[model samples]
Target: MLGSLVDNVVDMFQASNVDWKKIIIVGAIFDFGFKTVLDVLQYRSQCRASPPAEITKTGLIDQTTFIKSQNYSKSKLRFGMFERTISLFQNIAFLKYNLLPKIWEYSKVTAATYFHGGDIVAGIVTMLIIGAGSTVVGLPLDWYHTFVMEKKFGFNKQTFKLWVVDNIKSWVLALILTPPLLAAILMIINYFGKMFVFYLVLFMLVLNVLAMIIYPTIIAPIFNKYEPLEDGELKTAIENLAASQSFPLGRIYVVDGSTRSTHSNAYFIGLPWYKQIVLYDTLISENTSDEIVAVLSHELGHWKRNHIPFLLASGLLNAGLNFAFLGLFLDNASFFSSLGFNAGDMPTVVALLVFSDALGPLTAILQLVQNLIVRSCEYDADRFSVRLGYGENLKTALVNLNKSNLSSVDADRLYSTFYHSHPILPERLRAINEEMDVKKSAEKKRQ
Candidate 1:
């Protein structure tokens, strides 16, 4: 029977004599060290005298812009490195002193004392405690990053009171929604027992679908205002472009993102048959209508090529694998003992926390592959836009966007591959130009 096989596997794990605590600590250090190396590489690239000749040749990125972009990027990188170091040490110390088990015990006792002794209730309490702790610890860093760092770079638009309100709203939203969601997930895992991975993945898929449905309609409006894009020549052009591509354009909403930051973006969200595109008001304000439509052509390229679905499928696969990986270690008795608990009585919530923290370092190594796929898709989307006769406009829009955003257009190859989801600006421009040349050649041949 299945029980017999599981027992044998458990016995084998017991015999392995793995010191999981030390192993996890070493893994964390190694992962952090690798990332630090990437940071150093990026710093060197950013410190270069100028950007590549290709980017300079376009006469788009002037010396002042290039220097400003490098300085901004380098400053952010340094800030990020500092924050990450703090997080790394905190995690290491948390594990070293065995705080997770203590928190679980406290949550369990509290649940028993007041919540009528339910596992789900205890798990929810445990998560809330952890969330509160994280929020408190991160508050100062968040404040400094927003008020000091971003403001120094001329990006912060919110007043201190507005920032405070935003944080309070986020906390309230999390408090209202998180407990029930966590409890439901715990229940699914408990109900499925050994086959939890299979059921958990399905539950998560359903949850993701529901989130897509509710986020724009319900969740997003809570934080910011969404207004219909006004009737204009721009609107008419966007409609015609979508019609030419047979895109299922439903509604266009411009979100009030300028209240927080000057950065611009555009993305589509909805179910298969009814896609909605949301543009940052900043995007509309900053770009020409032609450029905005051209930028949207690149976005439509993502939909036309099924990139979103591909990413979704890949994400689900990754989640399934992570669940399976967790399953492997769940019955590893030594791991529980190292965390000051026994495998037989280990709380599912506690086990999940331990596994997530300990396994993250190793799991992160897989990110390179995901980044590679994403970068390729960006190139493909650019090419798609080029094929649609938006190549020149897209390039101009991209340049302006990059300049406005102060994006680091040049990057070290290794660091870029390991970190950036999109190709560097110069590389993207080169690819776009090549695609345009190819289109022109094909037209000539046909003629």
Candidate 2:
């Protein structure tokens, strides 16, 4: 069956005279449109469903807040649909007009004239130009989403100046970092031929590790102020929790997340030896000390369960698979020709985009699998908090977090399957409540 499907796809490609650019653009639109329509339908269906009796019975939020959350969800969904539709049309226009190839050619010629090196330097320069241009083009939509949509919902906490600064910082960072990475990958491809894929995977692995190490100390501080959690009962409780779990807790810092949005979150960052915990200032303000401790316990649970290393290993595996497919595409002349590029003259940058597009369906499958893994890990982490006797507190924190963020606590199951990294609030609350019941029953039996 699989072989027949592959043969059919190949036959279809062989029959079509469409340039690879057109094929990719059309395929992208179809793929995105299909997913977007399905998601919107799901959103609409959820909205139409009678509000769950559990929602009101649980008393997580008042009716007003519940209505507000539903409106927020629908508004975001409608906005997303609009954004994606516009993007799809823009992409079609861009490809149909051959703007990408034109830009690529222009960048190549300019870089060659100015740079003393060979194609590698020119390739890097072209990529940088293309990258910067893409970022610039997307900025307006980003501004609207951040400033207009979020502001309407009372979530925007950023000034226009801060937004501009962030954009500038992002572009500057990309300019500084991306060129060398592209240069190295191109050099490897030139030097090692097919083995370039394996080496590229290793390069990515090392780069990710370096990012993890530098992110907390270097990159993050550029965005938000991070102050060490001051001497207080909350600090002491967190320390005690870590000590009890035999977890090597590093410095705890509170980030000024309120500077950007009202969202509350907690995360663990840095290497094991230099591990740090960061709590959003909004989380600190919104939640009690016990609830905060409960949240940290869940985070520590991820560490205790080796979820970080597990995710890293999974990422490396995914990279290996991607590069393997990339190697196959690079070796196939027909693949390049199908995409409207002469096989003989295909640039590394162009080939990279084609390789990625070719593997889109496979990437989607892999992402779905990864999401399932992530959701399972979240459940395990929740259980870990329960084991630490913070189950009730964690449940309370989850409820409050969902309420404050205006997140729909219950989502369409199918939608959750595709999109949610963590279980919906109701599912999590059910699990915690069940665990508490079991614990209580055991205590009663002992008495």
Candidate 3:
């Protein structure tokens, strides 16, 4: 049975003809150029908008703060351009030289000599080596962004020691988790043949669920401290809001977000039974209790509207499609050979990298669609918060959050459509105000 399958796979490869080299080069150029143009256009748009002379209805910043924010945005744009330029050159060089296959060749030989297993073991070792190499190469950029840029903006709180420790912990965790997962994938392919796509999708679904469950409990605590939210009016307000909304109330915990950066955020972790709401300590210090409750109300709105499940379903659909295409390419030995790999000599990890690159354009289009959905969801959630009679408070929270995070309040429509997963600060504020006005008008009529 295995022999017949192998023969069939080889035959399929022999009959196939695809210009992988041309496809990769075109995709790389298109993605690089498109993103670079968008970045420049967005930056220009921000620069053209003058800071309000006084604080406006949208909570426009004072001139000093506005100037600082502009500078911060410019610095980030410059850094992103530098990073992307480096990445584009790196990717082109890697593809042109077929470095992945070379790395795989070296890894397989080393694995056979030192390790006591088959292709799966060697593939895992190869993937780890590649991952480690990439991480080391990118470390300087990450360090500069964290210690230099963020520090200059007064957002960074991470010491060099903490940064190093965090990276090491991340590496250790990846090592512990990745090999088994990769092995399972390889085993599925070996056993399931064409049906591997279906099984792989199943594996990914299971992995996603497990990650959601594990992240807040086992993984997150490795980096930051999490303590139950103190007995306070904030906690009482949050509980009351959740109760009023019929939202599942969970144990509220505060994360030491200021340990790494002054940027504030709030999110929930775990499924229904084991859920917890995590508020950044920075957020607590920066905003009022009502604003905090308003933010939580927005989050609860996501749950109430079933956005999570919808997102998950969308992701699963994408995964299924991706896995199906990947299985086809992996089985096609000619595809590997065209990229300087020997026919039938491709590793699973290498195949994944190549396949993802080949599908880059398609993936980008899908991402744009996903962003539209996400932005719509954001609007819906904002309306939900307003319906809870916290529209003004939520608006205040959004303004403060944007200011604290140094986020640009406005961007070009095209840029926002392509990149933003939520409406810009001004748009969100307008929506909230409109909702509030409608509510007030209805109340006056009733009176």
Candidate 2 is scored at a TM of: 0.91
- Winner of 1 and 2 under lDDT: 1
Model 3 lDDT per residue over 121-194, tens place:
88898888878878988899999999999999999999999999999999999999989988898888788988
lDDT of 1 by residue, 62-155 (tens): 8998999999999988988998899889888888888888888888899999978777888899899989998998999999989898888788
- Over all chains combined, what TM-score does candidate 3 have? 0.93
The runs of at least 3 residues in candidate 3 whose Cα sits more than 4 Å from the true structure, single-residue gaps closed, are 1-16, 51-55
Highest TM-score: which candidate? 1
Q: Per-prediction count of colliding residue pairs?
A: 0, 1, 0
How far in Å is the alpha carbon of 197 misplaced in model 1?
Answer: 1.6
RMSD of every candidate to native, in Å, equals 2.5, 3.1, 4.0
Instruction: Tell me model 1's lDDT, rounded to 2 decimals.
Output: 0.86
Candidate 2: stretches off by over 4 Å: 1-22, 49-54, 441-447
- Best model number under lDDT: 1
Between candidates 2 and 3, which one is better according to TM-score?
3
